[model samples]
Target: MASSAQPYHFGFKKSKNGELPSIAQEGFMNILQKNGSIFLGDAGQKELYLTFDNGYENGYTAKVLDVLKAKKVPAAFFVTGHFVRDQPELLRRMNDEGHIIGNHSWSHPDMTSLTPEQIRTELDKVREASARITGQQKMSFVRPPRGIFSSRVLETCKQLGYTNVFWSAAYRDWETDRQQGAGYAYQQVMSQLHPGAVILLHSVSKDNAEALSSIIDDARKQGYTFKSLDELKVKMYR
Candidate 1:
């Protein structure tokens, strides 16, 4: 089934007053369901999925990996073609250390604006490039660049054998120069804790790198288990 070309920027109301964040307002949930995409897991279970967008190396991913390793957490790193080309060792290490390497598109363009074939090229290039280095032949998950997508983009991803992964929790941690310190990052993440949350973080943020260890530790203390994307089971909410 084909859908409209209209683009949607992914977003949701942040959880507050001890509530799960809602993506219900904009038909985000509906579209995701229609396109076989996923933004949340089973809300009945206290499981959290950690994912990072690594468009380029800002010199913090190694530290992020270190923290994940030290804490025994498995996270997914959605990388762009540039990241694969520039940081082969990091990619290899991520795979070796038991992390899923995902696709964030080749040029990090708005996939909604590209044709299906163009979209395929963008995704294939990253997958092939990544496989060569990481030796993990199957790159199955994709997060669109800048959280922008449409029905067409989602369908293209499915046709190309990818599951589009959106997030249920995120904050403005992408602005590298305006970092508000690790405590602020910690607070932003901690406040949004809920069952089946897909947390999106940018590896370039120094705040995320600094706060990640605490985030994992405290979440576990609260009884939230961090699971790999492979273990994720999509749950549809109406």
Candidate 2:
């Protein structure tokens, strides 16, 4: 399968009234799921699969890890080649602490814009780099940079042995200088809290690091549990 001129970009549309956004959306998630990718989890359970996208270490990941450790919540950390090469200790700690290490691609390129060979190169580089520390550890998840993809792009991922993971809830937390304060961050996440949500938080956000502990505590108070991607039984096609 080959791609078209347009790439399938994953746009997160938060539902009003605090409800889970319909999975019926056509291109972004529906196509990915049909092609064996994962966006959410355990539709029947009130669980949130916690994931972090780490393109670079912004001096907040360690603290974020501390909060997750203290809260006893497991998470998935997806990293690019830069993060993997620069933050080996943090990656090791994540693996040692039982958090799932995922591939965010080597250089963080738009998969839909690349050929299958290029996409494989991006993911394979990160995979090999990560395996050195995560020895024999399986890196099964790949969150495409910019949350972009296409049917052909997703097929390429499956062919390269990855299950593309997208998110159901996220904010503009990746922009470091424009952080919307801790209170606003907390409210953004809390208001979108839904069953089977894949909450994508950037590990580099100071606000996220500040609000994580409370987020977990409050989510538990509201009867939502966090689950690692490892616990889910997903079908990854080749």
lDDT of 2: 0.82
Mark the regions of model 1 whose C-alpha exceeds 4 Å error after superposition: 1-3
Clashing pairs in 1: none
lDDT of 1 at 15: 74
lDDT, candidates in the order shown: 0.90, 0.82
Residues 116-161, model 1: lDDT tens digits: 9999999999999998997788899999999999988988899888
Query: Which is the leading candidate under lDDT?
Result: 1
Task: Mark the 10 consecutive residues where model 1 has the least summed lDDT.
Answer: 229-238
TM-score of candidate 2 on Cα atoms, chains taken together:
0.92
After superposition, the stretches of candidate 2 with alpha carbons farther than 4 Å from their true spots are 1-5, 23-30, 234-238
